[model samples]
Target: MEELICMDRSQRLFEDSRKVLVGGVNSPVRAMKPYPFFVERAEGCRLYDADGRSYIDYCLGYGPLILGHANPAVVDAVAAQLEKGTLYGAPTELEIDFARKIAKHVPSAEMVRFVNTGTEATMGAIRLARGVTGKNRFVKFEGAFHGAHDYVLVKAGSGATTQGVPNSAGIPADTTKNTILAPFNDEEAIERIVEEEDDLACIILEPIIGNIGCVMPKPGYLRFLRKITKEHEVLLIFDEVITGFRLGLGGAQGYYGVKPDITTLGKILGGGLPIGCIASTRDVMEHMAPVGEVYQAGTFNGNPLSMTAGLAAIGELERPGVYEALEKTGGYMRKGLRDISEDLGIDTRVYGVASMYQMYFTGEEVTDYQSALRADKELFLRYQQELLKKGVFLPPSQYECNFISTAHREEDIERTLVEMESALRTVL
Candidate 1:
């Protein structure tokens, strides 16, 4: 049996934080049963907690740290930009440069609008779709989390699902009436909706559902959506916040060979900083702000610091073998986990693509929100806790995807697999 790690300092801090912060955490997923560990520092693929204990990190800051924590390239770029200035409330050449990089790499980015968070990106994208198409209704997959905004919050995943509150209380019925919910990978449902709802503006979804643990689309599923949406005069919006740069420079659109009318991006695009982007063809993006009827603005919309960090991060990603290495490591980790679980005779299903992955404690295939829900969540949490005891940390909930990074060495993968085997054996 693995010895339990001490978290006395984290427990004390959580107690103090609860007096001021909601649920002693900024996000619901960060809250664990016995108080989450407060990190003192992080570097490479490891996180050091307040008690000075380090663990091999698979959470990777909830899918943002593709290069891993405290990457030197990102740090140096942001440091230099700090000396120049953080924000100017005016346009900078850096914005143009970063936007050019995005346009060059992302399939849907002929034009771009920078935002402060994923919530803003998706919110703006949905509004732009509505304005351009002159339609109020839009379709979002049941477990696909676009953002926290009222428009796409119905049947949301991530923190909302983790907290058992997929539908928020504050959002009114009138607001959600336009937000139609459909199951991921269900072509019939989408076909019916598109044909029946002539006023539907767009269909927004995560090409691969990361919010509910790395559920991928069925074969030819994306192309089918692309074809149907076009025939129906409805737009298709790809929410690539978690998959953006992590999947590749072109992201899911490029990877899957399907182009979206609009794309919302965050996480890896910021290089570990706060950033979001709405990108699309010039014809589509022209509908936003100073040029078109749709209005969206943010003081921090093209912050030089975020632009600089993004440029540096993308530069590193463009290097030869970066993505290949990440893919290899991810595959290695997933195979290891699958093998370990099989050896322990545990009923589980591992799902992933590229550097993103998740293991659901269920015998059935996890393809959609309903199938994902059937997984043994309590058992998964017990495994996560056991892995923590052995210095391997995954996201605390089964609904959240774990990530790999360029910083994870072969040795780290091997050690993590060993610990995972022990944890699975103990938990099962």
Candidate 2:
């Protein structure tokens, strides 16, 4: 590979940004050791950085850009919506259309309400669960991130997990007292907790824990959760913000064949724009706002730009053989990674479903957050930095999932594999 080009402009921008921006980044994960690369533009599977170097972006804007950056359809939709109005704070046919599509695609979405962000969606879902069940407490897995809200922030994942601060500092202890922690994929531990805790509102989790590097549920674990939550009359909320649309049209619920009482969606749902949704059965959804006392509202909810972009994005996803192609691409990359690891004599494991995967620099299976933490994070980080130098970008954090988008082509995968082999050689 050519010597990594100087990111002189990117470094200058970061230094300039630090004076105005918090920690030189709008989000924590974007703050790298020296500085994160500033992107000049992006389209399809590639990103052009400030220094004019291009890279294959596997982070995919933290799993939102499912069709990849600047997909023509999504861009056109947003452009057309811009010709209309941005926000009305009033209902439109666009909202109805998008909501209808969501209800049609997701099995649990009998009714749907829009929000501006995933944080609001999960917050609304939890509030509805509490109101409907007349209960105070809800259980969430240790490393499954719902959002930044107070209720689900305890033992949150993504940036929190990556930084080793699962529990945030500003949240009041009393406010989180009703928030319970459980182990992912451990039904027995959760069953015991559910049995013991009184006034339990719900059990919420990521069906496939993406924050701690895409840890999949043990076989039958989700089914067990469904059964037990139903038995106890506690609402089951699947925080599908990361998995929704990305896993498949029906998300993890459809993929796993286990339905939840409530579902929270975001990321790709807006087709790379900012949007979120909470879906549930009519009885449960009736508790929100004008119909019932439980209040949740957003001025930007169901805005035209997001609705249009989302419709276009989903339309592309619904194209025949899109998912099959995605699977093939992911499988191709996985095979290459495994081959490289074996050739380098590196202890590594790679596993994921559909277009998402994770690589842990350990031979053992990563079933939960604790086990995932045992992997060689330093080695993984070195590998990631090396890949970046080779004009390939993975997620900066070892704990985050590497996403594959519909725009990623055979050539992109092949080039990435070659780069991975070279990067791994240096790290291992």
Which candidate has the top score in lDDT?
Answer: 1
Q: How high is the lDDT of residue 314 in model 2?
A: 95
RMSD of each: 2.6, 2.6
How many backbone overlaps does candidate 1 show? 0
> Candidate 2: misplaced stretches above 4 Å?
1-7
lDDT of 2: 0.90
lDDT measured at residue 355 in model 1 versus the true structure, 0 to 100: 95
lDDT of 2 by residue, 1-428 (tens): 13233538898898889999998999888887768999999999999998899999999999999899999999988898898889886889998988999999999998999998999999999999999989999898888888888888887888987777889899999999998888788878988988998789999999998998989999999999999988888999999999999878999999999999999999999998899999999988999988988999878889898899999999999999998888899999888888888888888889898999999999898898888888998888888999999999999887899999988999989989988988887876
Q: What is the lDDT of residue 31 in candidate 1?
A: 95
Off by over 4 Å in 1: 1-7
Return the TM-score for each candidate structure. Answer: 0.98, 0.97
Model 2 residue 354 lDDT?
A: 91
Number of backbone collisions per candidate, in order?
0, 0
* Per-candidate local distance difference test: 0.92, 0.90
